[model samples]
Each structure stands twice: as C-alpha cells, then as structure tokens.
Target: MTEDDETALSRPQRRLLRRIYNGRTEPIVVEGLAFLTYKEASRYLLTLTEEAREAAYQEMKRQAG
Candidate 1:
C-alpha cells in the first residue's frame, strides 16, 4: 500500500444502513414486507409497538410449536 492508495481509501462509501445497529445484509421478513436494506428494515421495526412485537413473537412461537 502506498500514499496514493491510502488517500483513495480514506474516503469510504457510506452504506445504506444504521450506523448504531448490529446489522445483517439479508432481507427482514416483516408483517407483509420484505425490506431489502437494514436501514429500511430497522426503521420499520422501530415503529412497531411492544404489543405488536409480542404478538409477532407469540405467533412465531405457536407456528414453531
């Protein structure tokens, strides 16, 4: 690696994702949506209330059982 290469690498392309989150690149299967990006998916997940989250968890558990 040279000075020129280092300079080029300094400017990194920003990803379309939440910087604070531990993210996955795969699609998130929500109620009726397949969110392609963690950014979009994370935002939608944040909007769901605690009751909605619990209901979803119960439904998933029931299906698995």
Candidate 2:
C-alpha cells in the first residue's frame, strides 16, 4: 500500500521483462526440427513394428558415442 512496497515489487519485476531466452543458436535452427524430441519423433517416422523400434533404439544408444 506504500510507495516503498510498490517500488520494491517494480525492481524485481523489471528483471522479468529484461530476461529473454537467449539460448537459441544458428546451428540448431539451421538443423531444422532440432528441438523436436527424438523419442517421439522416431516413433512416428518408423512404422515397421515394435521390434524394429526396439532395434533402432538399441542402435541409437550404441551409436551415441
């Protein structure tokens, strides 16, 4: 209810406006759909069978070196 209380809230609120998500980069954007989660994406892309998905999952984990 006081100016001091209002000013204190404004000070911290100013930071909320200044904070922008700057972690984006050109490499990821150029890759196209890099942000898309691989776990779900692969399921839609590969419809061979659950066995194939399991094999692909194993292969992905193996190749992640």
Candidate 3:
C-alpha cells in the first residue's frame, strides 16, 4: 500500500493492525459489527467494499468524539 493509503486508515484500524500482528486472538466488535478474528477484520478494513470501509471510518469518528 502507498503511504497515502496507510495514512488514510483510521485510528481504530491502526489499533486493530497492532492487535492482530502482535498475536492478539480475540474477536473485535465495532459499530455492531463482530469480527471473529483479527485477520478477518484486518482484511475487511483494508480491502473490503467502500460501504464497509466508510462504516468503519464513521464508527471510529463517532467513538473519537
């Protein structure tokens, strides 16, 4: 991914990356969406449809404020 793509990820997305890559195995939930595994969630966050990505972004924004 480009630097701009990396920069575009939300705070929660970064946290998820850390959690997944650092060997955290628990599922994660965001905005009512349940991720059964970090890899699964990471995949969704990185390569899914725009609607899913936007939902994640909005959820992160909501949590931040």
Top candidate by TM-score: 3
TM-score per model over all chains = 0.37, 0.32, 0.37
Q: Which stretches in model 1 have alpha-carbon errors above 4 Å?
A: 1-26, 54-65
lDDT of 3 at 16: 55
The candidate maximizing lDDT is 3
For candidate 1, write residues 36-57 as lDDT tens digits. Answer: 5434544554455767744543
Stretches off by above 4 angstroms in model 2 are 1-46
**Candidate ranking (lDDT, best to worst):** 3, 1, 2
Residue pairs with clashing backbones, model 1: none
Q: Rank the models by TM-score, top first.
A: 3, 1, 2
**Candidate 1, residue 27: how far the Cα is off, in Å:** 3.2
| Candidate 2 CA-lDDT value | 0.34
> By TM-score, how accurate is candidate 2?
0.32
| lDDT at residue 18 of model 2 (Cα atoms) | 24
lDDT of 3 by residue, 6-54 (tens): 5556677677555554554444567576665545555567775678787
lDDT accuracy of residue 59 in candidate 1: 43
Instruction: Please tell me which model should have the higher TM-score, number 2 or number 3.
Output: 3
